[model samples]
Target: MTLDFFSPVSDLVLAHNELLSPQALGKKIKIHSEKKGFPELGDVSIVVFGVLENRNDVNYIGEVFQLNEIRKIFYSLFPGSWNTVIADLGDIKAGETVEDTYFALKTTVCELVKQNIIPVIIGGSQDLTYAMYRAYDTLQSMVNLVSVDAKFDLGDSSKPMKNNSFVGKIILDEPYNLFNYATVGYQTYFNSQEEKDLMDNLYFESYRLGEISNNVTLVEPVMRDANVVSVDLNVVQGSEVSLKQKFSPNGLNGKEICAVARYAGISNKVSSFGVFEYKPSKDDEMTSMLVSQILWYFIEGVNCRINDEDFSDDRSYQKFITLVEDQELVFYKSNMTGRWWIEIPFLSNVNNKLKRHTLLPCMHQDYIDACENKVPERWYKAFQKNSI
Candidate 1:
């Protein structure tokens, strides 16, 4: 069956207006609709799908998800320097039960990933990230998840699932495939001390909003290491996304959030990406345009992807070795992009799933810090995770 999950986009919104202009993105991209029908995605690189399920969103109960408003702005924008074929897969309607919706989403994502197609998810709630994570269950590898959010959302796993608490469910659920989880632009006041402590105890990473706002590039390495990246619009300040689920006065501004999205798209390992917690309002032009630009940057990044996985080609990279506190550290700098990576030595005779990830994305500052006898925290955490 064709999943029987997705509904046609042409049926969901008003008749195509500016979306059908010759130079508009809507005219250039394939749409899953009643007239033109579902996309024949053999050459498609990115598929955008909107989820209409939001029963699990604690902040906005029974609020209708208006993804079409987002689409109006997104599809009307002019294309960038992208050559990757893109498709708008339309919306996945809410099922009778939230679990049913999750199943449909998981099935859809799993299939897309299997076909090597990157899914750009516009979600009804951030809890949809749980379903996105479950889509990787069959891959048989440790999953690295990076979320752009203001709060930790580490609610009690014992209770019912909601957007605010889905991360706890992901952590406590079975199968045990999650390897690393990182939160970018997190505000300290929004998260409980216990949740903050939990992140530390697990050796997971967390970057404060102020820290990232001061240095946006700090998220690049984290995004590069991620296999799945989810953005909660609530991470953006109220001024940027005024209609977001939970508006905050202090958070990442428009440009910063878009940069984070672009980083996720540029990551060769990231196969699935989502933007959630958006609630459309009448005066939603700015929010919709912002979301559209974020999507644009992601596509732009995908178009400019660099293949730097292999280091055997001496002409492509420079290798550096430094001694810190009697420990030998090895790093590689990509001549093509100037990106740095540090080698995490695998233990002999160890049967670790992460043994294949010997080299991890890092910043040049980490190398400088290692030279100053300060071991980077990112390296230490990866080393510990690999030891486990």
Candidate 2:
């Protein structure tokens, strides 16, 4: 059988070393390396993305990527690998069996993540998320999902081969609770009212374009607990953009895209990330540059999350307004063996919409114990500092 998946693709980068790039958000570069492959869990990762097939725009006539630049990005992290492990998940033809592709992606992601290395998946289809979720949860046990896309990916489950529905498969199957689910930039036309109702019942936090545009501060709390983040490039609208099913018109821009990516990386809970739907089929140099910028933002955000211990903000009139609006942050506490969360909304220095809003470890047993029994310990007094 002639396979349409493994089309030859090009890659690039030069001698490995820790060097900064021109548009990088993070000033520093570091990598955790294997003896002859990608870095493991604790090590910082430097993955250079390339299309699985050569479709000119998709892989650029087998000249999909620059090897020298890839090497430069990797080496800039200063990791020493005898040989690099480059994973290409195949072209993913339109009619290809989903099961076959899913398994391949699942196994590959598990392998990379098992080594504790951050596996950054860059490719075309959103179906990649299904395999990613299965892999991370199966191998790592517990994980929370975050999606940054223009649609909820909740199409009909009856049609197995459709563009959307992987997410539907996951949620309807209850493979994981939809409680941790959060999405941004949803289009009304792209999603149905029935689907929205289902998501509400499932407890997924989502914001349409209008809501987020009116107030972006809503994203931080929704993502504070997320572990795996996925982004769809279609959320951006521009002439240079590309995709198999393009619909970026009247959407966010490249800088806003980087802002979200940066937020994901800065999330202390997020461990793995995927950027999908970046089909170079209609892409221009500007699109490539935008993608590159998003990557840099990811690195920079991670750096900021890991290093910045203090979570303070500038106190100003604008900040006060933001704080006032955010004071309605939600709070959730589990009383019955952690099976269910009791959600309550209240105002605070943090953003409201309550239910474990702050990721600052503020929902610990000690806090619960102190508040539940009205028994205040001097030690508990100091625990508030850590928000535990």
Candidate 3:
């Protein structure tokens, strides 16, 4: 039987007077409610879709999630000077089984990405990230995933799958498309020592909450190199989100999280983005608005994207080389965006995926550290991965 997984946007919600206002995003975009077909992909396009499947949440006790609460706030906000064609593709209702829902999401995401349309997924649970990651299998290439969360979410692979444990599945599963995984805003108390060691042993990257909260711009280079980005709303402080059920006492503030979202959107390589673990509360208007602004900032960043891929043009980029010990560290800075990247030398005849990726996105501080004879941690990690 053909699974009709997607439900059209409810007309009842569109009937809201505020959503139809001239300044509302709902008025400016194509909605899936009235049988409007998919938007044509031109220079840039974004398709927003929702997945309503939370059975996989480890804390699930058979509670329903109201995603439209976030949608209402999102559609009510005005957009920036964006040239991209934006569409609301409505929701993917939970399937008969969680796996069925994953299959539906996987298929949908793969199709959208193949058409060069970036998918902004609003998900019921973080485990939905597994399906999002699987969508890249058809593309038949390695992937770099960055997760913004309070926990590493790398639960035991031998155990049953849950929202908190999905990353383990992604790392150990077949097709093995994952090349690098980075967790931002992780709290040390939430993750075990074993997990921390595993992160290092696997050559993956993890940033503490304090490290990123102190300077949100530190994540720019990290996001610039990502192919997919996932945000767990729980990463934001409970005070900011005002959700007692799934909020953390210490985490990224509203501004910081939104900044991270925009950074993810600004990346030229990022194709898919997902915001998950959003448990709505009747009293929390702030949560809804914050989610709305996060999405808006992401769109704003997408509009600000510059073409920095062509490093061959000498005029477009300035090159710098630093000698540390016996190694030469080469760096490039873009004239268009002033972004910096360091070259990781490819190992000879290496059949691994890292051989395909030579440039490691870095910051000016990294270059300064290199000049001081201290090898940047990111450069060392990238070199180690390529060496393997």
Candidate 4:
């Protein structure tokens, strides 16, 4: 079993957990330890684990890191009135080769997901998302990947894989499981003009940092359609993180990043989530606390999830049809949750990547825009991609 690849949580963290209040999360979670063996997964809803591989990072210089501090902080916090059961599955130590580590992670994630368990991964570098994405190859026909990062990470696919270039590999590699890739909180200066052009040419989605910071709710609809969500810690503003972990002077604040995490957690289709690009430092209390809170919000969102996606019955949703120019736009609003979705019309002549008509999550404003004779950019992109 791939569980054997995991090392038990450190005794120091367990000792710390002993000091936490009975009502604290640390006291309630099922943890893997040297004496306790692996925890039973029968009723667990979320599994938290760490990956210790970082050689693929472009700036790597043999620095080692640990998630013990993050665990300690997360355990000390009090969970909300939550019913979801969480387990700490310990960490995956670096293997002899990065590929070996990827194999173990991919296999483990695939196993957990097949059992209807969500895996919240804390990683050493963002490239580990590649392994997370690969885990879905046999599980789903097509995958939607959402990356919260400052850059597109689409380096030359012909070159060796690195943290900055793994997305290129995902787009160019075999099996072709990735259907849509989106970026949230990207800074234009960090990406090249060619990369931006490529994103537009391919009909992928991207939202700038300025756009998201102005209105964080914009992330909800995009996340609702995602299957795999990967967050690069570098997306967090430098002031919100530790000295070693900071990537830019400007990025998502702690609250914004946590909100993004919560949105990911609330998505029914988001099976796997990851927070990556951690560089440990001596003074990491702030970063650790931020990450812990991010995890907390995600769990909170998971516990608050509502099953409002079933639109088979007329009683479950309210449908609206609007004419924008010559296009007929159809939208559905869940009677239970009030969330909205726009439909992508099926193409009879061309082979469809989605294979059938599907709903793209959207906001009420999209319906308003269509009523004004302005087509929503997201609907247009989805329509164009379907035609392609």
Q: Report lDDT per candidate.
A: 0.88, 0.52, 0.86, 0.93
Ranking by lDDT: 4, 1, 3, 2
**Model 2, range 41-131, lDDT digits (tens) per residue?**
2333433333232121222333333223332433333222212232322233322444666666566567656665555666556667776
TM-score of each: 0.96, 0.62, 0.96, 0.99
Tens-digit lDDT string for candidate 3 (1-388): 1127678777666677244679778787777675454434454388887899999998899988766777787888888988888987778999899999999999988888888889899888999999999999988589999999999999998898999999999999998888889999999999999999999998899899999978888899999889889999989887887554446689999899999999999999889999998887777688888888888988888888988968879999999999998999999999988899999987777765775578889999999999999999988888888777
In candidate 1, which residue pairs clash? Answer: none
Estimate candidate 1's alpha-carbon lDDT, on a 0 to 1 scale: 0.88
Q: Pick the candidate with the highest TM-score.
A: 4
Q: How well is each residue in 1-388 modelled by candidate 1, as lDDT tens digits?
A: 1548988885545366433778888878888888877889999989998998889887565668668878887888888878889998888989999999999989988999999999999987899999999999997478999999999889988999999999999999988889899999999999999999999988899999999999999999999999899999989988776554347889999999999989988999899999987788877788888888999888888887888877989999999999998889999999999999999988776777685678999999999999999999999998887777
Instruction: Provide the global lDDT of candidate 3 against the true structure.
Output: 0.86
In order of TM-score, best first, we have 4, 1, 3, 2
Per lDDT, the best of the predicted structures is: 4
- Candidate 2 — which residues are off by over 4 angstroms? 1-98, 140-142, 239-246, 307-388
Give the higher-lDDT candidate: 1 or 2.
1
Clashes of 3: 0
